[model samples]
Target: MRADARKNYEHLLTVARKVFTEQGNDASLRDIARRAEVGLGTLYRHFPTREALLEALLRTSFGALAKRADELQASSDSADALITWLQEIIAFTHEHRGVIAPMVSAIEDHESALHASCVTLRSAGAALLARAQADGKARADLDGSELFDLIAALAWLREQPSHASRADRIFGVISGAILARRP
Candidate 1:
């Protein structure tokens, strides 16, 4: 990819992310190209297909999230760090829910890159959870896989316009549960 083409591709990702958030998974690729000041050919050249675009968007977001979990682990109090990371993950899910839905559907049918990314995510989250538990700040019995499932459920709730507040409340409950003192 040449410098200008790379720039155009990055611009398209940014524009597509915003459009997907506002207009959802059904948002038009043509509109995305128009907003990015590119042609349909350029969009297809970069993304190839709508599913490809969605997967790339998901990978970008999930990569940032996994990175953030590492950063939080280094600086914050262990329990606070875990809770904060969970909150950020939930927010990412809400923002990318449109793209995530299809990726999730694909995973349900068979193994794919989406499944690989999910495995990576769970591994990262598990490491953080282990650190927190070892520090005696989080519930010792909490399983990372279970926590991840809860996060996914919460994220799904956040995708709905009417359930945003409900998602927040549920997050609070989960945070409280995980942070409760051990007997």
Candidate 2:
């Protein structure tokens, strides 16, 4: 890419991040282009679709979340690692607001721009869950896909104004259910 083009791309991402944070994942592309002081055509040149733009914006964070899972696996107790990673992913989805829908859909859609990142993150969570189960710390009936679905549900609550206040309490409830009984 040319220097000017690269600058525009970066600028768009910055502006899009702000806009998405304020208005959510459904924020208008035209508004992002306007905020970035770029033409809509220019935005399209860099990101042909909304999913493409989202994938670009979220790729780094997705990698970090996966890496965090790996770090937790090595450094934390099995159940603690699993719960910590779950909390992080839930917080991540809350930060991006309204991203859970696209992420959930992308997991089953190989051609989606977000598919690879979503799959990798899910696999990371799955590994943590498997480790916990192996250690007899988490419920054996739960699998990675179910864990991902639970995340989606939990994150959906966070996105709602009415439910946001209780989201953490509910997270505690869900996490408790995932753990095995000690006595």
Specify the highest-lDDT model's number: 2
How do the predictions measure up, each by TM-score? Answer: 0.76, 0.97
lDDT of 2 by residue, 45-121 (tens): 99999999999999999999999999999965899999999999999999998899999999999999999999999
- Please provide, for model 1 over 1-183, each residue's C-alpha lDDT reduced to its tens digit, 9 standing for 90 to 100: 899999998999999989988898879999999999999999999988787777677886778788888888796688888888888887777666565466455544444546666766777788788889989888888887877777777788888779886887888887888875756
Give all candidate RMSDs, comma-separated. Answer: 3.1, 0.9
The list of candidate 1 runs beyond 4 A from truth reads: 3-8, 34-41, 58-60, 100-116
Query: On a 0 to 100 scale, what is the lDDT of residue 4 in model 2?
Result: 90
Clashing pairs in 1: none
True-structure Cα RMSD, model 1: 3.1
